[model samples]
Target: MRECDPRIVLGLHRSRYERRILTSALDLGVDAIDTSFNYHGFSAHTALATAGSDLLPRFKISTKVGFFPTAGQAEHSLDPDRLREAVERSIRDLGRAPDLVFLHNPERSLTGSSAAAQDRLGMACAAVERAAAEGLCGGWGISSWDPRPLPRLVDGTLPRPDAVMVRAGLLAGIDVLEASEALAARWDLNPSQLWGMSPFGGSATQPLWGKLDPRVFIQSPHDGLSAVQATFRVAYWLPRVGRISVGTDSPTHLGELVDALRYEANLDNLSTYRRLLCEQRDRQPL
Candidate 1:
């Protein structure tokens, strides 16, 4: 919701609208918040801390690093200074150590090549190490679009991360089912626990506000509304799959998340979900 609306950013940072909205959203059973070091110039951290009396035990917060200027300067370069600044400010703003601090890397033009990606990945790793040493977070990790290269990139050289967040929706690169299983096997991770961000892609048609309706996603095949079902289905079958951490550049998507969770109560739909997984696997290009 914060990403989707400039108003949301404004409301959270400059006005009182967010307090009521946030309280309501938190009441809706969201177990966590993946906030940023740069969001709303520390107000997010402040609100979370102040609201802790009301919301802390209910929702875990996972903040990010590497971005700057919060709203407009998201794609800026990742540097040690920016990284350290974010960590210190976040700990101060939130008034507590974050449960997790993700070493965020916005999609850079350099990610396609092995050397550039590793260099970029290395910077993130160093930032995490710095934050961890300072006791700003419980653990540090990376978020990736593709996990195919992750094992090679992160497996042996640096300290093993406690967690990894990645994109695994139908619109994403990896085979969702296989990716979940492989990550668990290779990393000795619980597939259920991996953070699944942007189950939908950043397509324009997805609404940013109002009651979220999945039907609105019909135009964009890769929208989060479309992918969340796949995410839910996969998790239903892969019960060990941990929390489905979702984010959006739109508030309507937040509403969609609420709608999805409303009906996703049953965990016994394994047979149908397995069929869906097999269908996706068969359709992947060689």
Candidate 2:
């Protein structure tokens, strides 16, 4: 799966290209198409909704929140009213409701004291409930880059959605896979339900950029090629992880990405790890 911003087309002027991309993407035969609540001034959303309709019989649509920078400020609060407004706007923007509406940072709702946490949890739950009521999403879920509160949420202490989208990959070392496995076993959830992100992190640029330094979350010494392979391999085997979405902001990377996925599908664990290690080791100066 891939998460792309239709707005990356610049403005309404380049809409023709965006439209073509959307049309092409619909027929790309991918298993899913993901849109974001903050994608391309709502036009992309609308375009995707329409394009998705054409491929509805073949693909799943996953939409998310949690990076809406309003006036250059990052917004992470899961306020019910805010979330409802977002959904409504997204529906209007996309011209239809998505198959799934994921609360971008449900964990953000727990950043305060107990009372504040409760309030945030309530708001998040309300958001899901409202989405369900509106028939906006097939099911609701939470997307958390942070795992601090995930175990609790999935353990049933917190509100549970039909799924949980997480950030899992090599940058997290083995813990990435371990945490996911633990969650599945603990909650008895399927393996494919886990959604992974940032498999390469910085490993998307150069020899020392997107490389396999799993210990560095914010930096990568590997290239995007290595990152792509590593991520796809883990997600493929991570049991309940239904989809693996990579956040590649540039269109230039799309072609290489598609090729990588094609090659990735045929790779085994040993091959994947060897490639990651080779990239990492290569990054080390002789």
- Span of 10 residues, lowest total lDDT, candidate 2: 5-14
What TM value does model 1 have?
Answer: 0.61
Q: Of the candidates shown, which would achieve the greatest TM-score relative to the real structure?
A: 2
Please give the lDDT score for candidate 1.
0.55
Cα displacement (angstroms), candidate 1, residue 167, comes to: 1.8
Local distance difference test, per candidate? Answer: 0.55, 0.55
TM-score of each: 0.61, 0.66
Task: Tell me the tens digit of each residue's lDDT in model 2 across 1-286.
Answer: 3554221111121233244454444333344556566555435566655644554445456677654557755666676777777777776766556677788766765865666665667567767767876697777776666655555444454555676666654454444455556655555666556666554444455564444542222123234544544444444443336555664434445444454443333235435664676577668898
- The local distance difference test score of model 2 is 0.55
TM-score of 2: 0.66
Candidate 2, superposed: residue stretches over 4 Å from native: 1-17, 40-59, 66-72, 114-119, 174-178, 183-186, 209-231, 238-240, 248-286
lDDT of 1 at 53: 42
